[model samples]
Target chain A: MSTTLEPTDRTRIRRGRNRAVADRTELHALLADALVAHLGVTVGDHPVVLPTAFAVDADGPDEGGTLYVHGSVGARWLQEAGDATVCVTVTELDGLVAGRSAFHHSMNYRSAVVIGRARVVTDPAERQHALDLIVDHMIPGRSATLRPSTRKELAATAVLAVPLHEASMKARAGGPVDEPEDVAAGIWGGHLPLTRVVGAPVVDHQTPAEVAVPDDVRARALHRA
Target chain B: MSTTLEPTDRTRIRRGRNRAVADRTELHALLADALVAHLGVTVGDHPVVLPTAFAVDADGPDEGGTLYVHGSVGARWLQEAGDATVCVTVTELDGLVAGRSAFHHSMNYRSAVVIGRARVVTDPAERQHALDLIVDHMIPGRSATLRPSTRKELAATAVLAVPLHEASMKARAGGPVDEPEDVAAGIWGGHLPLTRVVGAPVVDHQTPAEVAVPDDVRARALHRA
Candidate 1:
């Protein structure tokens, strides 16, 4: 776990005036918490973005780096985008930051945009590991409980790992930004926050009778409503 | 609303062989329920996407047609992207669909991408309606609860409404896509559902006791846990 790159572009790509996190660890944590990301790539002259369930590789957590892993090779998007530069973005919607004035209206959100070259993963061991990370990223400790992939399954799959040492984050939290002119307008502008919580776990109808919720699954569930 | 002059190419973009979603109503529902969207555009040659809170104004039902509404003036994007061809994507991560094979792994996701000229809303009445729609989108009863926007606030702000009638929706759901040949592989792969919901309500520190949580607001708190 050696420190590799220091975040530059503070002047240009820094959080700017917003309160979104930019630290690699914080960014990685946010990526770890998110279940999916919107991956943007240019398809011909058109920009195409796909919703994907991605995972951060557990084996590569050193140096403030993040490796996002996602699958399904049949996507026409990956076919069109061989090794193109892409932007993978993940957002955690904490709540809506409602303000009085329509101008001051906003949301409380945390988002990260990773810009890098996209390559289809080929290594067997790494691909398998990436798949495990994808599983564990969803439910922290379920990867071990699931059966491992077969050789043929590995061969037919495609996973990409992008190092996120260079990226940017933008966020808007708190109530609102009311100008001096707006304050006197007598509008009771403030924050109406929106939050997302976990609901009571609905057991999959197909689960067998003997299988109960595992400790890891219950741990993740405790955080939600 | 009369059907506006919409080009064919504007509506039907390229297709994703395994991921293409041809349903029009499905796309509209996804857009209506989504509270935010990622606005993807090119900055110079690099693809830069900004995730902003957005709301869609459905002229009628989900399929009757809708328009995306978002605010910000003086922002480089809203200013530079006056009626320029842009891609606005809305997505809802319903659940995680684990696959038996690595290639079949995917998510239960519904995403809509609209490629068109995002016109800056100019009419005062329409702008107010758009603003109200944006608020109403986040909280169904918020627009009526808050005071209306002032003339000065309206003068400085801009809202872009992108037509949703000409948009395309793509989705993937259900259990793993198991290849017949690999059905005997014994990889216990299946979907792991994920969702976000409302947690315990934290009253605003300054909230007045006089104004209690209305049925609309309290209903979210008492929603099924």
Candidate 2:
């Protein structure tokens, strides 16, 4: 498939043939696993990429086809993304895959970048759903536990819906790039792995004493630790 | 102090006078927390930012103050950073600190971006030390675990030294911003905390039964999670 940006000649690290990827399931998995994404917005010629905690809002029956991203209506950058076309990139590094030779050293990583135009959602009815998506993005089932959004609180948030089909994910995982000659020379090589873990959750000092951790939250805590 | 970049300007994220910071200790901590950074280089205004795994290399006793970064010499980007004026950024998002007001929605984050010209270190002895800095950057004691680099490997690695004085770190930690008009809205807001955790060490399935997890690696694993 032809890319909208054509891998601009100078920006292409490897050849288009080397870096181009075509896979949907792989892309979805990457989007689901990442908790944050670096958003790049360009005004004039300069581009500023800011990392933001984000969750993917999949298309639903009642919703138009748009990837929902909710952030503080007060945030300058978030407001920009909500109003214009932007690039969202999610990346995860799996490990340091060592090669036997200098040229062979490499990393195992998965990265996905999506480009789309978004419009701020102002409808009162849709605003609550957007907040629900944001809440669900963090703790899957916590939306039900928390009180629903009030009319005033809903107005304070800005939700943007960006179409998600125009996206791509690229990944390289496995052993290092080792030249046969280097392997024979017997230089030690392999992968130094990496993983994300969550420590024990610290309860909020202001949380009411009567409330206990919900089942889903407890399960997530166990997974994180 | 006024920043060259304006706070609302699109060309860059201009530092607010109160938000801008210049401190070596803060810079160092941000760098220590980050394992990968986007090294920005401008080749005659054709700017490019590439992600690379890096480790800190300390300038020796004689050098009043400089920071060293280690990477593959074969990687043109690393070599370029060694000789050119560049900006290296390290950022960590501790939590999404929400406040009672829309304007106050903020985050607990620490970020350091060093803008400077990197000096190349070519001495054989200094090169070895630089390599050690890179190794120890990942695992403090593991540098001693592996055999020393061969002459060829050392030649292929690039070590760049940059003065720390020119660098700065920007940090923000607090609750949300609520307009006085919205003070009585009674919306719940605080922090949606975040952290990087290490999980159970998934030892290589092929590892021999005799080798056990090293103490330094164990400490790091427990500390981050």
Candidate 3:
């Protein structure tokens, strides 16, 4: 796979062109860090955007790679997404840029958008792998410890694969950019960094007392902090 | 306005009906707490989803209320969005639910979807008000402290307003819900609560030496922590 992202006509960045990032590595990193992605699909004449858990396979069987998103088989949007053009977006808010003037106030964020025609996963082996990737994406080393999924469970889930060939990323960081006159006003101008903090685990009430928090869970909480 | 959200055919919750929220107050609270919104619009045959800062006015001049999202006036998507049906989604991921079985794993999140035809804000006063709300939404009491937007700055920004009448919200909270058989296996099952933390201000290097961090910035950083 190429190290740089090749933006197509649809993926080209027009506005805020200065913030556009062509590095595929940055796109992969942003996807790995974000917990949720919003999937957009056209339903009839209008569009619908819903949040769902997503995972990516950098060397999967697709044009560039494969991006996987799963939903209940009964979900109407999931059924409508099959063989249809879709857009998936993941964003991380980094900070609040407080400029000397309101016109310059903005946000520090990293956002990625992927556009492709989604194909429903039909092969049992590939579907299983995609499901495991989704699970492990949320908690590292999680799917390895779980038992094999039952047939009923497998039948109840639907996985959609979107080729990562057409993807774009944009990010903004650091302090606010205020005008020279505003800077001369001697007012406060800066940014407050935002972060996602993971707290202690809240054990399920039904879990047996002998069952302890897994090593992966403990490590993730501390690593994210 | 009605106290409860009236979900239209497009806004109805078809899957995970248990997590659907019907109260208007809950929708307002979710919108207020969220900092970014994903806007989905159909450009030609495909859909495009992008993240942008958003604000809501509960008593604004719209059907139920008004949702404001701004972008560069030269943006292609913003130009296409005028008088077009669009979907706006805001999501807050609360926790990672670690179920004993991979099939049952999910994330606890609060998500709201609004579907409507966006109208470009042409009125000068309303556009100015919307811009102020967007700035204050990021930092409370921020817009009041800054100078009024210059005429050139106002001309360079485009604001789109979507009515909140056809909106729906769904949220999942607490621990994982696993099958009885998986629970009997005596494996760990719980959730790790996630939170957004704000760090100390990073003042711009160009700011005058005498300038100090403003009270609003300090208060928001501490409050969000």
Model 3, A98-155: lDDT tens digits are 9999888999999999999999999999999999999999999989988999999999
Output the worst ten-in-a-row residue range by lDDT, candidate 3 chain B: B216-225
lDDT of 2 by residue, B95-177 (tens): 55444433344556776555556778888887677666665665556566555567777776777776544455567765445
Whole-model lDDT values for every prediction: 0.63, 0.56, 0.92
Ranking by DockQ: 3, 1, 2
Worst 10 residues of 1 chain B by lDDT: B1-10
Q: For every model in order, what is the number of clashing pairs?
A: 6, 7, 0
Q: A2-55 in candidate 2: lDDT tens per residue?
A: 223223334334422454556555666676776666555543343345555565
**List of chain A TM-scores, every candidate:** 0.84, 0.83, 0.98
Stretches of candidate 1 above 4 Å error?
A: A1-16, A58-64, A177-225, B1-21, B60-66, B98-105, B172-193, B199-225
The alpha-carbon lDDT assigned to residue A179 of candidate 1 equals 62
lDDT for predicted candidate 1 compared with the true structure: 0.63
Misplaced by over 4 Å in model 3 are none
Give the per-residue lDDT of model 3 (tens digit) for B118-138: 999999999999999999999
Candidate 3, position A140, lDDT = 90
C-alpha lDDT of residue B212 in model 1: 51
- lDDT of the structure predicted as candidate 2: 0.56
Interface RMSD of each: 4.1, 5.4, 1.1
By lDDT, rank the candidates, best first.
3, 1, 2
Give candidate 2 misplaced runs (Cα > 4 Å). Answer: A1-21, A43-45, A60-66, A79-85, A101-105, A122-127, A150-152, B1-23, B38-50, B56-89, B93-109, B113-136, B139-225
